[model samples]
Target: MKVFKIVRVLFFISFFSFAQNEDYVKENYNKTETTITMRDGIKLFTVIYAPKDTSKEYPILLQRTPYSCQPYGEDAFRTKIAPNEFLMKEGNIVVYQDVRGRWMSEGVYDNMRAYIPNKKGKQIDEASDTYDSIDWLVKNIPNNNGNVGIWGISYPGFYATYSLLDSHPALKAVSPQASIGDFFFDDFHHNGAYLLSYWRVTPLFGHEKTQPTAKPWFNFPDLGTEDQYQFFLDAGPLSNLDAYYKEDNVFWQQLKDHPNYDDFWKSRGIIQHLKNVKPAVMFVGGFFDAEDLYGPFNSYQAVEKNSSNYNTIVFGPWSHGDWARNSERQSIGNVYFGDSISHTYQKNIETTFFNNFLKNNTQVTVKLPEAYMFDTGLNQWEQYEQWPPKNTEKKSYFLQNNQRLNTHAEKSFTFEEFVSDPKKPVPYSEDIKMVFTPRKYMTDDQRFAARRPDVLVFETPILTEDITMAGPILAKLKVSTTGTDADWVVKVIDVFPSDAADFPETQAYLKMDNYFMMVRSEVMRGRFRNSFSIPEAFIPNEKTAVSIKLQDVNHTFKKGHKIQVQVQSTWFPLIDLNPQTFVPNIFEAKATDFKKQTHRVYNDSSIEFTVLKKK
Candidate 1:
């Protein structure tokens, strides 16, 4: 029997002794500050925090940020040190520097996407700037133990990843939280789907257009932070994304140049270069994180598989901003965690990883295993040697009942036919406020959407026993749209409680990729559903089989939560409106080109879900 003691939800974790000790390091004024010039002749603004009594040497913790390195910020009010903490203020020195092209740093700020690296006969990159910055910090900073480590969240997180590239030996550990791997795949290009709305919105949202010329840049409404947004009504470079900004944007042009996985995407691709990691690092991500779930997870997996370096992965049920700002206890809707788990994981787990490797010179694997995940259904955290558990069996459930799926015994039924209008795509919700968001309803009451003539819904009856599934989910459907090209958005939803009487609290939605969504896995352009690397026009009304793969999904269907699978021809606003007319590039297709089309799903061994379930 295991005897586990309860840990209070609230507790303090002081990083370094000096931060708490007033006499050790004066938290008041500039203990030390300077701007160092890199070997490339670009000046980097740097600030150094040192102990008041510098009679002895201490380990250094380094952070490189593009978000302006404010020399004297509110962070001073907090103590940096405590035993079992990351910012053990007592260490050698803490360093912060502004990345090139940001803040006071010299060099024209070319967004990271325009990274010009000095590869063999290739353009030079910010990687060298990172290399140069670290090199200068180590040699110049005083009261230094000479040991250094780097860390940053989000964009700075990107800088943190590059710090190790052509890195110095003295560099120790790093933690990249919600960091982006490649702008193409994870950021604007989700599963190869051109996230046009988010892409254009992000640049403006981040004030990227202001660049080096627009000094004292202003912050606008974050894309999703606004109270309400009429995306088309807003007048700006971003509002007319498909019109004014489509091919004109520099990065957009670059992305188009590399359509269909080519050298362009491969250049900034960090996965291949992860080998020979100099620092013991930790990549953090939220399972529900919309921004960069793939960044930390993929980064961790790539490094572990491609190289001999050891790293750790921490995955929790969190959205983009959940892990930090919200109550670590729980967040949005009715999803309440039993405890302040986020708090513990953030302070203890994150700080521990940094301090242990950078300061203590200890191994990270000993304290906790390489991978740790919190399971929502069980309300507990579990440790595993690897992801997708070693012993996972693949399973499948067929689509029937006029596209209805049920465990209460189901039988094959005739295929369904519906006419889809490109102009009036089925909105995901009944309310007009969310008309642009057509996919949200896929997670909600399938009943409302199934009534639509254009949608196909397959549902399973309430389960008698919990059906546990772990790993990615896939949908192999034999589908044919009347038009030459169209989009198909699939969603796997968990219907905890039926809407017949009351709404259930527990629910999760996983959106599938259009052929565009499949770039992360596979692509099924409507013209080539039954074929590959070639285009095949829909024989007007000919029936064909096409496999649609929903990305891997993990969930356990408790005795009550019904499993729902929804299929639609369009996921507007989330995806560009398919013109329903085969064209060279739908992004530029004229309005007149769009047409009303009839789509038919075949049933002769046509549609099935390769789902995983318990024996």
Candidate 2:
């Protein structure tokens, strides 16, 4: 039921066949199944795939996942076992396990389970489970060199991060790719606003099974319509959706009860506990990853600040778990980046990372840089000595009159006004199809949004020189609303030149000219403007400062391209519509609480960015 399961299977079937055939995997590898007992006497089902040729001892590469370790029997073999074909063909004792309470593993499953520190005997957490598993692997698994490495994407990636803490001596390397650092900021919610687009995926983790099984026990809700925006709008308030989940869904009920960042959510956060990490860590994520952009960046920063363990980060122009695939051409939505981008990372970055630390006979002399980031605009890779390169300077672009984004603020006080109608919310994308959580919308064109009257668009003139931004973006706004509550959505866009040509991979109905490519965007529920734990209502018609932090960017605004900004109240079904009227819990807000409100953005509003200096 993991969110990445479908994409992983599709990628495995298509790419793995080309890289290494199923017959090759069945011929060279031997599969075995066993259950490892934890300190609490709970058994976790594990599958091990080791090379038949035992001439040389190999390192252990493990992936512990809430998603089931499929092809459960000893006779059945996976198409590709290792992280990539390079590692699979080269040979390693690849391991996959069903994390506690999931699949065939015996225990209770907790979403983003909190790390238990300084534990006594029989204390259980993901870290402890990982420790127990590694201990068992090295002792029982034959031909293992006593060196272990862990890697996973999405939910499994979170487990990889967990393994870093209280790690076994044999665990030398760890790669947490698109890992969830905190559910509050990751998949389910963004800045305290619930992501309604992800509603379809609730059944995956919400429902509990009577017993562990290899097949899915929860069923997805069938909306029976492709138009998600209309479906959510017709469904009305969040409370109405309870008809679908009801009391059977544990996670949905928990979400409704804890609308604020109280003890429940604070304890579940893993970022605060990423201290004294032992394993050599490599944090990987996509710049356009719609689901987990906040997780990897914040987790990496936490590790950098707390631990002295060898750590590095890599950001690519991928969406969600795209780096795990072996596609010849890499593209997100209407734009195509480069060919074999994921393959390059697998061969040069991922393969090199594991082999360097896990293999005793490795000849890898070149260590990865502190940061290996991809520039979306340039469509190229760049290495840095450190993240947010120390040479960067802070710059602010002000929202001016005549829809201009300038270096200076307006001389006089002026504001642009727009009426936000909850009944007619703005759609996040032009596409009308339903999705579990739309990934293409991250880099989707914004022409449809800009044309809307509710959305305010501000753009700077065509840049005479290339300007690159390397760090996080701060959207500091001076705004007010007639109603007591509202949600602020900010977007940073890259406007292509008028004469730009479409690439071969461009969408049939889309063009490259004047494409309003969304570089970054974030939303902040006004109620949580002051403190996440304490809800505050905005004074009607009073100008207040609301600052939203958009995720970090390693993008360059080319010489001919224009830097643009868009501000709006609603992002449609992407995020649940906030009732203009202030209410204690938005989850319980009735339909009558929703109201139309006129919002204003003053000219003094500005966006702050870390501008990388020209060297």
lDDT measured at residue 330 in model 2 versus the true structure, 0 to 100: 93
lDDT of 2 by residue, 376-482 (tens): 99999989898988889999999887899999886899999899999999999988888867888988999999999999999999999999999999999999999
Can you give the TM-score per candidate against the true fold? Answer: 0.76, 0.97
lDDT, candidate 1, 113-179, per-residue tens: 4344345532346677666667776777666666777766666667777765677787777777767
Poorly placed runs, candidate 2 (over 4 Å): 1-18, 361-364
Q: lDDT, candidate 2, residue 486? A: 97
- Angstrom error of the Cα, residue 113, model 2: value is 1.5
Please report, as a residue range, the 10-residue window in candidate 1 with the lowest summed lDDT: 3-12
At residue 424, give the lDDT of candidate 1. 62
Clashing residue pairs for model 2: none
Instruction: Report how far residue 224 has shifted in candidate 2, in Å.
Output: 0.9
